[model samples]
Target: MKAYSKLTREELQTLVHELKKEYSRYQSMEMSLDMSRGKPCKEQLDLSMGLMDSLNSDADMCCEDGTDCRNYGVLGGIDEAKVLLSDMMENNPANIIIYGNSSLNVMYDSISRSMTHGVMGNTPWCRLDKVKWLCPVPGYDRHFGITEYFGIEMINVPMTPTGPDMDIVERLVREDESIKGIWCVPKYSNPQGYSYNDETVRRFARLRPAAKDFRIYWDNAYGIHHLYDKNQDYLIEILAECKRAGNPDLVYKFASTSKITFPGSGIAALATSSNNLDDIRNQMKHQTIGYDKVNQLRHVRFFGDIHGMVEHMRKHAEIIRPKFEIVEEIFSKNLGGLGIGGWTKPNGGYFISFETMEGCAKAVVDKCKKAGVKLTGAGATYPYGKDPKDSNIRVAPTYPPIDDLKTAAQLFTLCVKLVSAEKLLAERTGEAPEKAEAQA
Candidate 1:
């Protein structure tokens, strides 16, 4: 368990030889396993089968507000769905807008609206000379994808366990007028499952942005995705904090039942201030008459309430927690003292962020792929698919079978060792590759 950084060139070369044998055996197996996406395994997906039964030919179709869910008139959402998602999103029912199946879809539309219109009547971003966005590094890829799709200049803000570097955040936001928004996965964040502490939440609330339209895109996707019953992450509710700080329209919060029940079929919602809701509704009225109220009713009737959804998530934990443990144990057993890398062990959320030696992440991923395994591309966690250090690979363990993940994880560690050793050997000879290996 000695640190690999302390090893002599000869020792490193010997380890590389052994690791290559292991890698070769994996290659011979031709095992095409994938650990690239944070999708629920089959068993986890099966836990919500009752959702299909919740609605049928003879079920009650009218919500409490007298609107028949079969037809369409409730632009915001049905009252029952609003109640259900409001509690889940930790906001007032009046502040919630139950969108269609995908939260990502709603986020995309929000950006699109801002581009054509603008936030709360600021100048349209599309007409502006330059529109910029602050992105938290080692963050969600789709968040970056949204901003990138809109042609917004993205600035990377380093993330700490507490949250993004708030000093720099405050400085840039205070000084820059074009910085219109920032993407945040505030609770049990994607890739690394770190939650922002109370101070970070307060700091976010108190931000003095130069742009009047500046807002925080708080995608609390994993707010209730706890891996343990008793040990869970608690995030200070951003909507309330913004209100308390007199920045009532400073944030927009989103969540869904994707992980709890179904992904593409789940109900997604956004929570924000009453003023913001009014503003969004002005345009939302034109987007659709309403979303799928029948599916929303099915979700509400199936879960019954927030408590029911939480109980269902516990079932998911039972099925997938062992898979998480298996991967973590394998990593610890194989690479505990190797100073060449590090990784995050999160209590909840779907991804484990793995770090390889500087300039070695793409090489390790390429080695694993050649051995018939797939991973999230090395730079996916950062803005524009570029990790400046060429490290930080996101390892997703929830999709594969447990036994398969173990083999994949071991093969992954072997690649790590081989790549690290090669990097270290190159360093010993005062040589480094001018151009790094890019993951295909």
Candidate 2:
């Protein structure tokens, strides 16, 4: 239980030796476990099987407006779908547009459209000399991937418990004309599970950006995803707050049932001001006749309404909350008060972010891989796959079964100890890891 920092060189070396033997035993087991992606476990996926059953040949295909869901005409999604998602997003139905399965796709297309057609008639971002984006550290990697793919220069904004540093955010967007947008996971954020507080949301809503096209990409992906029914984190819904602040078009809010019903197969949506929705529709008419309306109908029939969706998500919560607890329990028991690392105990969201000593994340992940356990690649939580401190490692516990997660987590903590000990031993002896290994 003693902190690694207080350990003598001999003590640390001895610990490393014992950890290596344990690591070797794990390697000998030839285990191939992956804790990399936030995929729902089979049991969790099974909870939504009723969604498939929600549709059948005998079922009525006519939507509320009498539009046959089997046909393609409604570009803005059916009235029923809009109402359902709008209710879930806490926005007006008129402000919502349901898309294909993935919200990430909607996000990518939003950026791509701005690059080519510009936002609400501004000059295309492709015409700009420099395009920059604000990326919160330890954020969703795919969000950064989209901006990075478009050759957008990303500036890292440190994340606190509440949200991104607003003073820096306010100052940067006010002074920097080229800074176009920021990626936010406001409710139960991707890796750390931190939610934005009220003041942070207000400051974000009130910002007067130098760039007319500046926006906050408020991806409320986990709006209703809670591990504890009573201890949930609340996010001040951005679209409404922005409207109240007189900056109705300052943010684009996105949500999906990907985590709720099925990932990549569930309905996605974007909620914004009517002006933004009109602009999108103008261009969207040329994109396609419509997205999968039958799928939209399927979702509507499955959930029946927002209340039904909420009840279904509670089923998901029941199945996965224990998995989150298992990982937290293991991490707390093995690593607590060790001073070698620290990790988040998120209230919701698919991942738990772990911060190892500076320069140790990659090494720990690498060691875990060699022992037949896979973690999310180190530095993945940052833009351009680069972590300035090389410290944050995301632990995805939801995908694996309970027993497998236990083994994987134990291996992960072992890797942490081995790597931390090596770093310390190297510092004290001024020797390379290989040399330190030989000595240990």
Candidate 3:
């Protein structure tokens, strides 16, 4: 149980030998377990089975306003859907536009629009000499991918427990005219479930960017996703805060029921200022007659209201909370005080971010993959898939069942120890860890 660094050469070698034997046994099992993405498990997905039944041939296809959902022409969304998502997104019904299934899709479209047409009559980003984005380190990889796909230069901002370093964010946006936007997950953020504190939210609302088109892409993916009923993280409604700060057009907030109901069929939404919505409509008008109104109506009918959605999420939390707790328990029991690595115990969200010894993360992940377990690639959390420290690994626990998660988590910790011991042994003896271990 001693810190690996404090162990003698012989002791470290012995530990590595034992760990290798255990790892070999795992490999012989030839099991294939994946923890590479934060996806809702079958049990969690099962909770929303009634959604399909919410709409049937026997049900009326007309919305509350008497518009038949079967036809097109409601470019924004049905009124009932707007109200449902508005309550969930914490915006006025008039300000929210419900889109098709995925919030990620909405975000991608937003970025694409900004690039081709521009935000609210601003210069199109494609015409700009340089387009830059501020991305918080250890942030969402898909968010990074979108910016990278558009050839936008991404700058990393360090993340704190409260939020991204506002001192840095404020200075960068104020001085750089080409920095168009920053990606944020604000509540129960991905990888690390750190929520933005009040001061951070205020500073973000008050930011006076050099670029008139600068926008905050607020992806509140887990706004109400909490593991604990009594203890939960609350986020300041960014759209309202922006309006109060006299920068109503500064942020575009997004959300969806992808996790709540069905990942493949849930409704997505964007809540923003009228100016931004108007600009988006100009492009959306040509895009299609409208998004699937039938799907929107289905979501509205299924959830019934915001209260119903809250109750539905409670059911989701019941299924997911234990998976999170078990991972925390396994990590603490195996890796605590080892001085080798550490991990986050998120109260909500689907992931737990682990920070390994610098330069050891990639090796640990590779070891796990070889032993029939898969983890998110090392350095995948950062922009451009490069982690300068090469230290962080995101552990996704939501997809697998409880038993499989337990095994995967234990294997993950075992890899951490095996790699940490190898790293220390290499540093002390100036011999390759494999060579030293063979000599042991």
1 versus 3: better lDDT goes to: 3
Q: How many angstroms is residue 56 displaced in model 3 relative to the true structure, after the best TM-score fit?
A: 1.0
Model 2, span 243-346: residue lDDT tens = 89999999999999998888969999999999999988988899978888888898898889999988987888898899989888988899999999998988
Writing each residue's lDDT as its tens digit, candidate 3 over 350-437 gives 8899999999999999999998998999989999999999999999999998999899988899999999998888877899877766
Once fitted onto the true fold, the runs of candidate 1 whose alpha carbons sit more than 4 angstroms away are 432-440
In model 1, the Cα lDDT at residue 367 comes to 91
lDDT of 1 by residue, 1-440 (tens): 68888888778667767766777788999899998889999998899899999999998898876778999678888888889888888889989999888999988998999999999988989999999999998999999999998899999999999989999999999999999999999888888888999999999999999999998999999988889998888888888998899999999888888888899799899999988999999999988999999999999999899999888889999988899899999999998887878998888999888888889999889999999899999899999999999999999999999879989999999999888877776666555632111110
How many clashing pairs per prediction, in order?
A: 0, 0, 0
Q: Output the lDDT of residue 107, model 1.
A: 88
Question: What is the lDDT of every predicted structure here?
Answer: 0.89, 0.91, 0.91
What lDDT score goes with residue 114 in model 3? Answer: 90
- Which 10-residue window of candidate 3 scores lowest in summed lDDT? 431-440
Stretches of model 3 off by over 4 angstroms after superposition: none
